[model samples]
Target: MHRAKLASFAFPDRPAGDAMSVIAPQAAVPRPVSRVLVVSGDAALTEQIVRGLNATAQRLDNPHGLVALAVAQVDQALARVGSDGELQVVLIDDGAADLAGSGPAADLAVQLAALRPELSLYRLLPADAGGSSGRRAFDGVAGEAIAGWFDRGEVDPVGWFRILAAEVAEKAATPFYDRLKAYVALAKDSWHTPGHAGGDAYLGSPWVADFHDFVGEELLRADLSVSVPMLDSLLHPGGVIAQAQQLAARAFGARRTYFVTNGSSTSNKVICQTLLAPGDTLLLDRNCHKSVHHAVILSGARPVYLDSSVQPHLGLFGPVPQVRLLQAIEAHPQARALILTSCTYDGLRYDLAPIVAAAHARGIKVVVDEAWYAHARFHPELRPTALECGADYVTQSTHKVLSAFSQAAMIHVNDPDFDAHLFRENFNMHASTSPQYALIASLDVARRQAVMEGWRLLDRSLRFAAELREQIDATGAFRVLTLDELLADEVRGDGIRLDPTKLTIDIGASGWNADELARVLLERHNIQIEKATHRTLTLLVTMGTTRSKVSRLMDAMQRLAREARSRAPASRPVPRRLPELPHFNRLACLPRDAFYEAGERLPLLDDSGQPNAALIDRVCCDQIVPYPPGIPVLVPGQVIDVAALTYLVRLLRTQQATDLHGLADVDGERQLRVLRREEAAPGLAPAV
Candidate 1:
């Protein structure tokens, strides 16, 4: 709005005497515009548009706020975005265009054309006022070629702007992937890491060589190192990787996207490690993956754990009740971040859109671990993904749902306050120096596939899952978990829906527990599920899941359910419940402190009341994680209490394979590694 602000609008206005900020100045060139800039004109509807943009900016706490530049002339509008590319799409007043190339609008168009050159400028006529993203009913849609480039149509102005912005970004970015492909095709000399050297050099063993022959030479060739200059480095990707990330950012509706090869775990850690500092408070979902706790330990942030509501019917953790979550937010006003588990392992999730806004309003960063929801945005029923919900940070395990190789993942960043350098530093710290090139390429291909064929693939997946659910319910032995079950509370309050691609099966009333049913499927039949809880088995219906496979899975489940009912006595396993917390557990010592403290292994006591107050109050110096979901029950330095201890003990009894990391349970003698409290440690909150 003010001429004095134009030059500095690209950078945030520095507050006078505001000593320091957590955010470091970044090169805004690599970042997308999170806010919109509206240039005013004489049209009566200009004010409404301006209001809409400003309201959105305020709502999202967009790092870039609204700037109403009142420019009577075209030069002023050009001046707003010319020197600084910080301005998002500029919306000119309605009917303000003069095709004659003489009026203010035409003058502005000429300047944009002369400067930016190839920017796609589309004109859309709206039938009526619409919502944000400007989605509206099209009356007459037609295309008029502009130098065989421009097309005319009537649609949502907001949607058009987003599409236009993405196209412009993609066009401007260098094609790193194309160059890498070209380099791969060259089939150059054997040079880099991995002693095999592209599977060309024989190992001098017939069996090993035969294995290599079977695996093919391309596997090793594509597993090239970062030394290959043609395929740019991921850590400092200014080339193809950056372009891929930008493409991902747009595809995922993010301001920025960072590719993570280690999986969503590393992505989760990166978000926390970058945003939080030592002693800072972060609101955490009690049911979050253990990696979030690992990030907390690494960052030295204090966690204000939110309680999870246990689903009695399914024996699973539902979302932290919104009322309870809001109360936690109100309690910890100074929290640096709010981390939520968007969808649980069994497909239970909350509509975090409203929560993100609420958390953002309190100046808290929002991070959602949507690790199981990489394909959520492909369909409308699975709408309002964490990215669409406006979370500051969202992590997805692409391989879990998409066709990418295992360990290929991505982090979508949409926050204005995100520190890219800080994130990269952590990412580099965790990422391998000799990265997997094939996985990286797969991520690129996966992103493209999702962008191109996602809708059709997801639609098919939904049909498959829905049909199986209906068929399974008809068998009478299993009752399928519905979106209605998870959204009962949310639907009544907000319109947030569930991902139809994930199926949660309930056999709580049957003779078989989840593990028993899962075992039968894996051993008797050749079907495996994503995860299993006490009373439910979770199946991930992905893009690759076919109708034939769905039919087989349904048939197997029905037969197994009928057999269990007839052959086995009806005995229902108790639904797992979060243990009631103790005073010491509620007031956790910092996880970072506990993680670093000296610890000694001591025999674990089964009786909760038998452990001395000294033992219970002492900081835990070991991670006590349960298998399956592998979430931490007690992280290092946190006070160990009856509830957490009890939960862990139960978990140890029921937990199966996949590495029970950080636990000290050996044979029948349970042991715990706890912090050896010194006499000189700082005082806690006087034991409440």
Candidate 2:
């Protein structure tokens, strides 16, 4: 059994800049764990080796003191190695070693080394005098070699054991960063696409000069084109860009990971284009981003949407019920792929292990839209990641929850079963030929941060989340959803656990609802949340969230609960029941067909001054999507109904800024774009 606890293995206190210093002293608490794993038949010799390891490790300032796992055979060794995240080295006694596998000692050692790339391996041979039990049995030139491995003194040479090192280590190894630095040093002439190359072009221009200064000369200097050979090309990476991707793939536990500079929106489109085709069934969840619908429209895929389950009291869509997934799979078994959103905008995640297994059994490919879950894999407390849950394809917005710059995302592929050549072609189609070098670097370093510092940062983030939840709960006016609530009898087996970082506060039953609550927080308290729904408001906490900001928010909520609701406007209309999303049967044709067909624009309301729900045989040619939820109420070719109108009207009335998209008013006319009634035949091919 793995004895090391992540709780105890928390890196020791180091100087402010030494972020990669896992071995350092802290007088407050000296945790245990020195040596990683030791394999030997002799009890005394193993003890001596453990003692030697502890002496060196403790002196080097490791808080986790003297950790040594003595396994008699390789089976137990592999199990121990796999289970422990703190393993650093492995030593085998070749003489009396009863290895777990059926192989020679050297072969067994090689096999164990393959288990973890970071683990150092050594073999203990017979001594000259006392055959197996000498005091110097563990001492030799080989023993010196064993000590030499530890004595090299660096904790993790590859930088995998820690988060982003404050300073990128000075080595010949970092290809991408090295190339960029060298290119910037040259300060060469630029005949590039970006007009402000080297910031000289903006120097004399009146309006652009101030903006150029604001952006800084150094930044523009590094924003070089793909034509620069040393800097490497994103379109067809060979030198540095390819190496960076491989490093990230290994760090994130994926077979391969493609970096995207254009955010997960383009990443989603690439995945769709690669795995799906025109008329191919795509089992999609209705509660996905607007970008997903666009992908469907672009690919002309036949969509079979999963029934969205609602959190009745909260007005949020809960996880798709297990039965709903089963029914969809049974109905659309011919579907080429399935895409599910885990850790969605409001922080709901399905237990995907079982679902992925069930789909894979039927030869179905699974893709999880994990745009908000790049930091999930680093923490044990969080829900398991898409790759961990056996998805064939997964996309993550690295910038969302991790430390990457905005618009930077990662697409991880685990499918040895699909066409690699086709996937590469599709990736090139969506990804820009000349990507921003900074964005690519941000993703590279973000992956490093997630691997190295993720645990530390996430631990702090979760702790902060718990504090907010507690503070909010204490007020007794505002309420938050907990995993316990989702696990209760009426809601059990729905496969959900809240992302603690996404604090979804229920303000509906506070007698104030979301609009009034959001207004008071923004106008009076000067605190802004992410988005507010009819019944809820969401606040996103990432690695960068601080305790002080959280405290301010909590204090603001306390005041809002005690005074703001009662003191605020009174005539607020309580929202009616949230309308169920329009089903697939409501469509006149596939989304792509309506998307390209000739569309007519008409007033959203009738001449009698009401919603034009009574319009004679008009099909919606736009995805009527509100901003916060962004899930379309009706996609192209879908028949708009009274229920859809009811939801839209209530949504507009309660929302603070009232952001509605897709359908718009055209020049003094409140308009709805629809397939013209005259040509609205159900199966008519779109006029290309």
Candidate 3:
């Protein structure tokens, strides 16, 4: 019998000036225990395997030892697997040769496979088990579900322990990140495009040396170019980049995954262009991000807008009514695609499974912009993500909630007939030719981190959010908006769910408007919130949110409440209310044509400082979107109406810290871009 020896864990040495050497001086962090669950009614066999694993850890001088837990009942095992995020492996003891011929044991195996596909499953065979018969049984019973089988008669217990450790380590590997780090350790001479030349340019000059010191040397050194063949090219990825994307696809439950260095904005455009062509009809959410409107214009798609419910008092917009969406789908049977944003900026998610099914039945592709819900798939409580709910294409801003750097995003494809060649052509059109290597590497590491520790991190975040909500409500001055409050009456029975991590607090009774509270929190307390509306403030409790951060925010709120109460009562001015969001208006022409046509900027207000009513009936040549929730009020080609103009005027008059895009400030007046009189005429046919 050949015996395998455990290798000592050590990093390779790098040269003195190497980037690795500069950053490698650090203390050794302790590793967490590798936990394995054993399913068997036989106590004696379980004990033997557990002891062997512990003894092997001791002999190898492993910092963190191995621990095996045995659960006899199937229900107990399932509970442990679901609750314990640290579990790495599962060993099922099939006493008889027939692993599948049983009651609870077989059922346990099936449940584990479905619940945790990341787990490494190994079957424990009897001592006398041998030959092709045992192998055949294992394969036939679970197929690829069972990773491998261990025969007690053939191998010693140490070998079994080693195999389990190896599996855990494999899950923790960051392919692109590890390779990038290794290449940096080489300290090779650089004649790269980046004039910094591995930061030597900055370091060599006395004037810029301070800047280099401030930014750190490792970042510039790791910023290598495609000239270095080892780091691989983002545009034509066949190496570690491909492997990383494959891992991400599996982790995110998609057929294929593509890394986006540019943000979900670009991802939205790429998907839209790939799916739609000139004159194609699309059903789009009226409250979608500005990027979706840009996509509609760029793709030359004629959009049939679906109206979203608006909370006028709260200054918020919710998801489209289920009845309205279904009606739109039925009305537009020739529509090529349906696009919507799940989990709106304030965290209201649609019941997407039925919606996806409805779209698919009509041969319409469904694209879900899940830019804020990237962390949804990691926890069971957040299941049924857009992709899991059968979306054809889903775009996620990984950097928004995950550990990835800014501008890092991902596009997941789950279409049955996904055109790889056509999709790649469109993706390359939006993708930068010279991509940032560090951003790509971050995407790789982000996937590994999410796969390994996401459940544990999200569990902590959910708990913190819950505690904060209760404590904040106890203040009485401010109340956290519950699921019932966030959902509109129209979407009550539509099976919509609000993400608990998003805490929207109504600050009406706090004696301060949302803008005032946000400013005070930032200026006095040095705390910045996610979004603020007229009467409500939205705070995102993500995986990165800590207990200390939550406590500080609560303390600030309590102090502000007390201060407001102590002050003498004054004549409180009535806060200005935002106008109701306008419904989808009839387009005078196609969005693409109106956008590309000759246009002139018209002042929103006339000389008397009143709204220029002349601009009301004119066709808009640009999108008028209010930032924070970057939803467009007037998309290109849409004819301006009283309701839409009122919304814009109120927003400008209030000056409520909301950014107005596509509307410009010219010669001390807010201007709206509109098409010429001839071009704005109605009944224009689609350009051939």
Candidate 4:
């Protein structure tokens, strides 16, 4: 059993306050050191070594500066170094062995030589020198002793300098396209990205014949491998892939840009992992997409949730108030960053500048989930993007509103001081091992489309939204929630944010439930609104909508509302509070842990007191989640919350609900797998 311990010292000890420190000049070392390559697994350690090298340069009275590139993974570092170079001091982090269990230090040394021929490499003993908080189980060496290895000619200085110089030279001269091409070849299209592989017509469904004809064959041909000639390599590259990424960086006003193939879900995780560690605290908006919450779990970081203002009448979450973020950071002074969603799903936009300024006041980084606001950068009227608001990391999902295919996204680092290397490392770790070439090509073209015609396209879209809103109001049967109603004094506190792009039609006063209205519309007219709830039916509009489509939607909504009002009013219990999303405090076991942990299957009522880890067994396979809002009623690692239970029971009672095939039937079946009571007795090992 892993027993949790109280916090004694969050950080390791440093040199005792330097109370009696003395400055001494060290002996001069050998010359001809033009470059230095510091190879380490830990980025923080690499930073310390760079600082140390600057000190070393000053002490040696050397005029030439050392250029360093620190990569977390050894494979990546080796790939970065060129064949023509000689290395001065190749410093490997002691923790690097855990990166992948290859072998002992001797084996590691040999592998290093194989990667770069005739290189002088030296391993630094992790002691107080690097200031690592974790246990250092390697050779016992002190800070002065580690520094001695560098200053006292313990390694071949001339060879080390040659290797580092060669690596640096290669990095400087390598073209981005070449790297991209290599990555394309290395990437084999699996069942992963680009659900369509090379646009092979044979594999496509007959129903997609028209789509295939509409989108040309050239588009598919260009969807070649990311490993193709001179493409930017995912692991390491210097070619067109690099050029494309660089172009994106320039277009987005970012220092660097990373193409994300796994959509905003992965993008969220990458941002969290790159900027924060286990001990760091993050301020999160309560209405954040489930992705941010998942990232927090993966990163092992605690979060201070800033509840966004919700519109009770509208039945939607709003953007977080700027003041709440300030209060949160002020309360948790040590918070490293704040994450917020720019424009919510309902199309309500939040001004991000004030929030950014507040977070930056205390040197805290701001990350914006601009997934829904992908068109914001293109449209001047939209809320300021993460770049415009001066956020450190901005994540955009191209597929949400843009023409790019699904699972397509990008992460931009806006700050100069932001760690590009760390971002790449974390991104590479969580991202797909084998990326789809189609997505890379799509992202390349998507950036061009967004930049060239985004503003013009969005302007048309805004006009269409306005026209639709007007028509919905014209229909006396249903009232469209307008700007006045949303901003009214009485509704201001109840309603937090409003996005004009969405057509949120209120069916509450029309004597019909939102669900009934939605069903009637779909059945009567061949038109469908998004999911409906008890109060409202939301309609989403993007670049895909035309004036004709809007007219038809208004016609259908008007007819449905009229038909609903003609019927007798049905009496039902009014829910006072909106459904609360589930929260998890601890993981009884990892996904793999729960897979292997022993437990028993029992009825749902009998298993209430027993600990349970949600798994993918047939009984638990069907995720009994609310449909309109797809928040999981019971997540994989959480003890089912009270809301979840009530929601499940209510969902079963509400036969009109479309989703929940499994849980709705759970009432009849007395079955659930949980920890056995006797096995979970005090002082005994828990069964789960």
lDDT of each: 0.65, 0.70, 0.81, 0.58
Q: In model 2, what lDDT does residue 541 have? A: 85
- State residue 418's C-alpha deviation in candidate 4, in Å: 1.7
Q: lDDT tens string, model 2, 283-302?
A: 88887777888998899887
Per-model TM values vs. the true structure:
0.72, 0.76, 0.90, 0.59
Q: How accurate is candidate 1 locally (lDDT)?
A: 0.65
Instruction: Give the better candidate number (1 or 3) by TM-score.
Output: 3
Give me the candidate number with maximum lDDT: 3
Candidate 4, residue 124: Cα displacement in angstroms equals: 58
How accurate locally is residue 181 in candidate 2, as Cα lDDT from 0 to 100? 76
The backbone clash count of each candidate, in order, is 4, 12, 0, 40
In candidate 3, which residue pairs clash? none
Q: Which model is ahead, 1 or 4, in terms of TM-score?
A: 1
Please name the candidate that would achieve the greatest TM-score relative to the true structure.
3
Query: If both were scored by lDDT, which would come out higher, candidate 3 or candidate 4?
Result: 3
Report the lDDT tens digits of candidate 3 across residue range 1-688: 2323333343423235644322333534446766888877767677787777777877875433467777775677778888887787898887733333346444566777667666778877776555677656655446556777787545466888778777776677778898999998999899877778888888657798778767667788897877888877778789988888888998898999999999999999999999899889999888887888999999998888877877766777889998888888888888898999998888889999999899899899999999999998887777779997999999999999898999999999999989999999999888987888889888988888787778877888898999989988988888998878887788889998888888899887777867888999999998999888777889999878876688789899899989777755574334567766667668888889889987888998888988889898788999888874567888888889888888788787785677888888887789999998866443644311
Candidate 1: list runs displaced more than 4 Å: 1-177, 202-204, 484-496, 568-584, 606-614, 650-661, 666-668, 683-688
Better of 2 and 3 by lDDT: 3
